[model samples]
Target: MSSSRRVRPLTALALAASAVGTLLVTAPTASAGDYAGACIRSVGSRTSPNGWLIPARNFQAGSSGTCVREIQFDIAATIGLDPADAPGFIDGAFGPKTDRYVREFQSRSHLEPDGIVGPRTWEALISRTTD
Candidate 1:
């Protein structure tokens, strides 16, 4: 009924709006570190927490071993490639189908589509998985 009463409600409304704005502005968005996917591992390497090393040797079709399997798992999981349909499906063997998926992931990730997983590719894959 008085000027002070009216001002108090307006001030309260303004404070509420400001608080909401602040929250919206400060809200965290998805980042490279936010990826908590199952494929991510800590290999204790200097490169990434995701474990897959920047390969001393490139991994391409015909490569095989645990590292290859890890790469296949990361790439497939990152790109949402169905494991059931993924050739090898973490079998640790790099085959033609795995090569194709790697190339697809590379192209999407703005990397060279050589189907080879090197340091750069491993970094990109790790970054993407976190995203």
Candidate 2:
């Protein structure tokens, strides 16, 4: 198995048009992250020509940053749950509400119901699967 995702850039217009059939994004067949509940990854921030890149840090109730924000966005997209309902979610700050949602997502996706976003949790979110 390879931890490589594929991506085809769509024009901004195309992306703005609709996401139904305009994007070509795929997940890695192998794990791209081994975060392991640690928040060590706090630097590398750039758009990937490849599809999604998993974060190397674990986001918990106190994490806050662009990476956390990205994961927050994906949480709603993957679980099809509205972020507004979770209060402080989707705002880059992993508060108690985000923790709750993360745990709920973990349980729903058959991952450990630990309120931490580790590699597996990142996979579930960035893989864009409800799981």
Candidate 3:
């Protein structure tokens, strides 16, 4: 014996619509406090000086640059991690400490627990700054 399953056109449409609705309902939305009062500094002509622009490449362990420095500062500030306690804080180096903090932040934000600082993580960090 063979079993066959068939979906009516109306049922298919309803299922698609329901899926879309669910996505819309569960989608994350930035709140007023997210980016309204966030202070992102500008570096010359760079549109995103504070590393707001998603980098061409993912920032992982060992990545170092001005953008990395900006990301470090933002992540530290977002997670309320004091930079004063640590020497060379926000030094633009993605080290173990930074990875740990990033993971912690990601966990808190319900993001993937990967240590790489990508666009989604950056958005979550940048948009969550308090005035």
| Candidate number achieving the greatest lDDT relative to the actual structure | 1
Clashing pairs in model 1, backbone N/Cα/C closer than 3 A? 43-51
What lDDT would each prediction earn against the true structure? 0.68, 0.64, 0.67
The residue-by-residue lDDT of candidate 2 on 43-85, one tens digit each, is 5432223444555557788888766666666676666566367
Each prediction's TM-score versus the true structure:
0.55, 0.55, 0.54
How does candidate 2 fare on TM-score? 0.55
What lDDT does model 3 reach? 0.67
Q: Which model is ahead, 1 or 3, in terms of TM-score?
A: 1
Between candidates 1 and 2, the one scoring higher on lDDT is: 1
lDDT of each residue in 1-131, candidate 1, tens digit only: 65664458889999999999999999886333432221234223445335644444567898886567667767767886764665546676788778888999999889889988877788887666643
| Worst window of 10 by summed lDDT in candidate 1 | 35-44
The alpha-carbon lDDT assigned to residue 109 of candidate 1 equals 84
Task: Show model 1 residue runs off by greater than 4 Å.
Answer: 1-53, 82-84
Clashing pairs in 3: 34-127
For residue 18, give model 1's deviation from the true position in Å. 62
lDDT of 3 by residue, 1-131 (tens): 55988899999999999999999999876443333223223222222335564444467789876656766676767776755536676666888888888898899999898988776776776577634
